[model samples]
Target: MESNYHTLKRNYNQLIVITHLTQLLTYITGFGGLVVPLIIWATQKDRVEEMDAHGKSILNFQLSILIYSIISIPLILVFGLGIITLILIAILAFVMPIVNAIKASNGELPSYPLSLNFVS
Candidate 1:
């Protein structure tokens, strides 16, 4: 008999919330904000309800932040505009995960503003 594991769809709001919050790991450990979530999403997307969507949003947001930060580096040489942009990006990166985590806990889809569609 074939195992039914792949056909199972579990409601794991807590895992989804955790996935969203993992974005903060970059702030704490200077890394893993993307890596952790990417791993979780990859491993659980098929098993956990809504994991794929949440994972995609998280990845896109992280990628966008990386791109924005890279562009801002050159702006730093142009009257310190990069500093301001970097600050805003930091704030957005820190805040959006918390907001999306709250939404995930409520069974709502996450919305990351300014994220590019890199995965989907």
Candidate 2:
């Protein structure tokens, strides 16, 4: 019973981490939100299966947005086509992560589309 309780708590903990990790931009504590999940999941790999699942989801979401920004930065100057759209995309990139965190917190495994999911 103790083991089962511990497992349940750990799973919930992972969900909590995944849910709040994206709030980093909103304030500041969420800064490591991008990396901490991976670290925790890696270190406690066998302790909670949910940790690995949520961690990879969060990691990939951040990484994909990162790649999108990298590609967009260069194209912005070269094309000069849609500055407003670009800005919105940038904002969405940041906002979506937070949204994902919120969804995860509610025990929903929200998967961002086109994410790399490198950890998996």
Candidate 3:
């Protein structure tokens, strides 16, 4: 099977930014986080060749965070702890992604805890 690869040099930077923003968006935009990146990822998927290995790593890491948040928020709500649970998740969501981006920029691929591999 063929793999989808990003092919834009600037896009690698964009992916890094998008990844960071998407993670923050889970808390800031409340749902837009999932939407924007999913759309970008879908559009950018076919051009992975444009994306450098660093870019691919960032993309995969971001994808993992995004999918995890998508699944976790609803599950956290199912617990019904009222905003607090969400707030905590949001906090983690913010922190972890930032760390990932930093690590990515430093040429390290950080494995997100409980993240599913959405970018392959």
Q: Each candidate's root-mean-square deviation in Å?
A: 4.3, 3.7, 7.3
Q: What does candidate 1's lDDT look like per residue over 43-93, in tens digits?
A: 998988789999999999999999999999999998799999999999999
Per-residue lDDT of 50-74 in model 2, one digit per residue for the tens?
6567767767876776666677776
Query: With candidate 1 superimposed using the best TM-score fit, by how many Å does residue 79's alpha carbon deviate from the native?
Result: 2.9
TM-score of 3: 0.54
Segments of candidate 2 deviating more than 4 angstroms: 1-11, 18-33, 81-86
- The true-versus-predicted C-alpha distance at residue 62 of model 1, in Å, is 0.4
Q: Which regions of candidate 3 fall more than 4 Å away from where they truly are?
A: 1-11, 49-85, 116-120
TM-score winner among the candidates? 1
Candidates' TM-scores?
0.90, 0.67, 0.54
**Candidate 3: residue pairs that collide:** 5-47, 5-48, 5-49, 6-47, 6-48, 6-50, 6-51, 7-47, 7-50, 8-50
Deviation (Å) of 80 in candidate 1:
1.1
What ranking emerges by TM-score with the best candidate at the front? Answer: 1, 2, 3
Q: How close is candidate 2 to the true structure, as a TM-score?
A: 0.67
Model 3 agreement with the true structure over 15-105: per-residue lDDT tens digits:
7555555656656666666666566656665664332443344456556655555666667568755356546656666777678667655
| lDDT against the true structure, each candidate | 0.91, 0.64, 0.57
lDDT, candidate 3, equals: 0.57
Candidates 1 and 2 compared by lDDT, better number: 1
* Candidate 3 residue-wise lDDT at 63: 63
